[model samples]
Target: MIKTLMGSIREYKRDSFLSPFFVMLEVVMEVLIPLLMAKIIDEGVVKQNMNYIMRMGVILIVLTLCALAFGIISSRFSASASAGFAKNIRKDMFSNIQKFSFSNIDKFSAASLVTRVSTDVVNVQIAYESIIRVAIRCPLLLIFSLVMAMSVNFQLSLIFMAAIPILGIGLFLIISRSQPIFQRVYKVYDRLNNVVRENIRGIRVVKSFVRSEEENRKFQEVSQEIYNDYTKAEKIMAINGPLMQFTVYTCTLLISWFSANLIVSNVMTTGELTSMITYLMQILTSLMILAQIFTMLTIAQASGDRIVEVLGEKSNLNSGTLSIETVPDGSIEFENVSFSYQEDSDKLSLRNINLMIHNGETIGIIGGTGSSKSTLVQLIPRLYDVTSGVLRVGGIDVREYDLSLLRNNVAMVLQKNELFSGTIKENLRWGDENASDSELERVCKLAQAHDFISALPDGYETVIEQGGSNVSGGQKQRLCIARALLKKPKILILDDSTSAVDTKTDAMLRQAFKEEIPDTTKLIIAQRISSVQDADRIIVLDAGGINSFGTHEELLGKSQIYREIVQSQTKGAKVDETE
Candidate 1:
């Protein structure tokens, strides 16, 4: 985990190194002040010498200023290094996510990734800043102060030995017990974020169903779980404060009592006693700071592990070394192919699928809910690789082609259409970034989208809300179809994309496809029989296998499923006409 995280500190190594160097200088200067003060009290004030007092006091002022300067420099560098490190990690995680296949994404929830990128990174950043700045200073302060105290008077220094061990044991116990609780709290945070995201995204449905009270109760349950975990961990950690105070005061009293007796017997001087007390404060204060650092590190450890998990995951799909670039035609063939999301699962999502499609042929696919229509098309783009047999595109194995070239040639508008927050032109440009204005209008007209788009106040330049919430469902589908058409791909797969448009509009879109792009292979998945009745070929799927494959009329006459669907739809249309 540590090695994986440290790789992101690519350019910040200099800043990370300089922070501790300045901190060390500041700590050394602070340790010198008390010794110089002891001299001013003993030699100058006792002998009543004005010159000696002025010289030592001037030196003290200069040393104090130097320490302050060093402290400011240390703080600046540490903060810069930590912030830059965090930025790089976020960039790396997002880049990695872009490479993830559908199976890879299935292993983690969207909410968990959001939490890891935002909240978990912040926790680790705070811990890193403290490690670079205070971590370096505290140990140096403690060691230097201890040495100076022993030189001033050895017997008095022994008092700290007893106090140090007791405080160390107390801190160790507190941290060990609280570490597990802190780990549990971050997991609960994932659940809390998931709940909030689901409620916000589905708020319209929630309001329609009058389930606001149920959402609130679910959110409160997760929120309260987080609160309970944090409260328990803090209660365990709270012991550090009182324990540190007791040790500081107890050591101060013992040192004061021992030194006062030594002074009366003429074994120690008053100046040395004053310096010893100052050193005592420095040592105990360092211990207290160390305890706080340990607490922060424990919490950051859990967050660090979560972040490393994302950075370390390797994508399951890889582009093979053979770099066949251009697809010759839209022909596709699946030979005895089978796939399962999980290797150990009992049933495959697609089983023994074998089919061949010629270039520029129009195919229609119909199936029940679990018939794997979407899953079959996804394999063409290598969205998920097949588990068992060979799948070929343009007479070559898809795995042998460059991933980008293969996907660019095969454009897919999935069952759920997504539009980002931008102007309509920007959303459409995702298909071809360098497409001209004329090209944009051309595709929109073919998809039956140009009419509505031109009717809008700003036409192609109109701003769209996130997820295209401002447009009706049918409009959203038409815009998505236009975007895919802009690609001019060799094969265009529409997965129930025309479900929202009316029957007349749907028929017009299909007619437009036939006239505008005769050389492109088109595959349409639909529930309506009329939608597929005119295709060159139709495929009916059942229970993860092909039920039948033939031309529309051949299937209507011979296939039981096709005959039943046509009769039902034709009967329903006639009754509506009679009424």
Candidate 2:
């Protein structure tokens, strides 16, 4: 995990190194101050020499300023380094997520990934900043203060030995008890984020169903769990403050009592006693800082683990050694292909699927809810590699082609059309970034979207709200279809994309396909028989396997399932006409 996280510190290595170097200098300046004061008290003040006192005081001022300067430089460097490191980490994690296949994405929830990249990264950044500066200064200050105290008066310094062990043991117990609670709290955070995301995205449904009170109750339950765990962890960690104070006071009292007796016996000078007291404060302050650092590190450890998990994930779908670039044609062949979302699972979502599709052929697929219609088409672009057997595109194994090259040649407009917040022109440009205005208009015409788009006041330049909420469902689907048509792909798969459009509009879109792009292989998945009855052929799937495959009329005569679907739809159409 450490190695994986450190890789993100690429360009910040210099700042990371300089922060600690300046921190070391600051500690040295601080450690020398007490010694200078001791000199002024003993050699200058005691001798009644104004000149010597003034000289030593001036040196003290310079040392004080130097320490302040070092502190400021270290802080600036640490801040820059930590912020840059965090930016790189977020960028790396997002980039890695883009490479993940459908199967890889199934391993983590969208909310969990959001938490890991945002909250978890922030925690790691804070810890990193502390590690570079405070972590370095505290240990150096402690060791230097200890040495100076013993040099001033060896016997008196032994008091710290007992205090140090007591503080160490207390801190150990607090950290050990609190760490597990922190780990659990972060997991609950993922759930909390998930709840909020689901609630917001489905706010319309929630309001329609009058489930606002139910959602609020669920949110309160998760929030209370977080509060309870945090309260428990803080209760354990609260022991740290009182324990540190007790140790500091006890050691101060013991040192003061011993110093007075030694002063009376002339075993220690007044200057040395004064310096020893200063060193005592320095030593105790360092211990307090160290305790805070340990607490922060404990929390950050969990966050670091979560971040490493994202960075370390390797996408299972990788292009083979073959550099096959351009697809020869729209032809696709699936030979005894089988797939399961889980690699090791016995259950299969698609089983022994064998089919052949010639270039420019129009195919229709119909099935029950879980028959894997989308799954089958997803394999053509290598969205998820087949669990067994060979799947070929353009007469070549898909894995053998460059992933970008293969996906660019196959366009898929999913059931749920997504439109980002942008001008309509900008959103459509996603299909072809450099597409001209004329090109955009042509594809929209073919998708039956140009008429509505031109009717709008702003036409292509109209701004689409997030998720295209401002547009009707049919409009969104038409815009998505137009966008996919701009790809000019060799094969186009529409996974129930036309379900929102009326029957006449759907028929017009199919007509445009036949006239405008004759050589593109088209696969349409729809529930309505009217959508696929004119296709060159249709597939009926059942229980993860092919139930029947043939032209529309052939299936109506020979397949019971096809006849039932057609008769039911025919009756519904007649009823609509009668009404």
Candidate 3:
């Protein structure tokens, strides 16, 4: 785990190394200052020598300034290294997430990933900074200060030996108790973020249902969980302060009592006792710093594991070495294809689907809920690879093509259409970044989106809110269709994309497809019977397999499922006409 995290410290290696080097110099200077004071007290004051006092005072001033400079440099370098390391880690995690296949993505929730990138990275960044500066400085200061005190008077140093064990054991117990609580706190944070995200995305449903108070209660529940866990952890860690203070004062009293007798007996100088006292504070303060670092480590250790889990995951789908750049045609074939979300599970989402689609053909797919109609179409673009058989697009296996090339050739407007926060032109340009003004207007017209857009105050340049919240549902769908059309893909799959548009507009969009792009194959997935009745061929899916594949009239005479669906719609239409 340490090696994996260290990999992201790529460009910050120099800053990381420099931070500790300067910290060492600062600690050395600090240790020397105490010794120099010992000199002025013993040599200058005791002997009443003005020249020696003046000279030693000058030396102490120079040493203090040097220590301050080293401290500043260490802080600057440490800050740069820690912040840069976090930036690099976030970039690497995001880049890796982009490479993850749908199967890999399923292993982690959206909220968890967001927490890892933002909160978890920040926790580790602080730990990293502490490791380079405080972690390095404290141990060295403790050891050096102990040696100086012992050299001054070994008997007085024994006081610290007793204090050390008590502080160490107290700190150990505190950290051990708080470790698990800190781990649980971060996990709860993920849940809290997830709750907030869901509430925001479904705010409309929540308001329409008058569930704002319910949502507020849920948010408070998750928020309270986090608060309770943090309070528990802090309660355990709170022992550190009083424990350190008790130990420090106890050690100080013992040192003072022992040395006072020695001073009266003329065995130890007052100057030496003062220096030993300074060294005692240095030693105990270092121990306190070490305790703080351990507390941070407990939190960071859990966060580090979460980060490593994402970085270590390998995407299940691999783009093969031999890249097929050009898609010869829009032809798609599914030969004995079977898919399941889980490989070992007996249940399959799609099964034994043997079908062929020629270039420029318009195919309609209809199925009941959970019939895997969307699953079938997703496999064509290798969104999720088939578990058992071959799925070929453009006469080549999708895995063999460059992932970018294959996706570019096969454009999919999914069931849930998403439009980003940008001007209408900008969102449309996602399909073709270099598309011109005329090309943008033409595709929007084809999707029957131009009229509504033109009615808006800004027309094509209208700024869309995030998720296109400013636009109506039908307008959002048409804009998504226009965006997909901008791709000019050899194959276009509209998975219930026209469900929001009126029947007339839907028909006009289909007619525009036939007239404008004759050579491009179109796959329409819809619920309405009228939607698929005019297709070149219609596929009826049932229980994860193809029940029939034929023209509308052929299916009406042959397939039971297709016939029932048509009759049901016809009866509903008749009832509406009579009313």
Alpha carbon lDDT of each predicted model: 0.92, 0.93, 0.93
Error of 2 at 62 (Å): 0.5
lDDT of 3 by residue, 1-579 (tens): 999999999999999999999999999999988888988999999999999999999999999999999999999999999999999999999999999998898998899999999999999999999999999999999988998899999989988877888888898899989999999998898899999999999998999999999999999999999999999999898888888888889889999999999999999998999999999999999998898899999999989989999999998888767856689999999999999998744879988999999999999999899999999999888889888989888788888988888889888999999999889999999999999999999999998999899999999999999998899889999999999999999999999998988899989998999999989999999999888889899999999999999999999899999999999999999999999
Judging by TM-score, tell me the better candidate of 1 and 2.
2
How does each model score on TM-score? Answer: 0.97, 0.98, 0.97
lDDT of 1 by residue, 1-579 (tens): 889989989999999999999999999899999998889988888888789999999999999999999999999999999999899889988889888888878888889999999999999899889999998899899999999999999889999877888998999999999999999999999999999999999999999999999999999999999999999999999999999999999998899899989999999888888889999999999999999999999999999999998888888888878857689999999999998878533669989999999999889999888899898899999999998999999999999988899999998999999998999999999999999999999999999999999999999999999889999999999999999999889999999999999999999999999999989999999989878878889999888888889998789777888787778889999999999
Choose 1 or 3, whichever is better by lDDT. 3
In model 3, pairs of residues that clash are: none
TM-score winner among the candidates? 2
**lDDT of each residue in 1-579, candidate 2, tens digit only:** 888999999999999999999999999999999999989988998888899999999999999999999999999999999999999999999999999988788888999999999999999999999999999999899999999998888888899867888899999999999999999999999999999999999999999999999999999999999999999998898888899998889989999999999999999878888899999999999999899899999899989998998898989999778867589999999999998888644889889999999999999999778889988888899989999989998999998998999998999999989999999999999999999999999999999899999999999999999999989999999999889889999999999999999999999999989988889999999999989988899999888889899999899888888888899989999999999
- In candidate 1, which residue ranges exceed 4 Å CA deviation? none
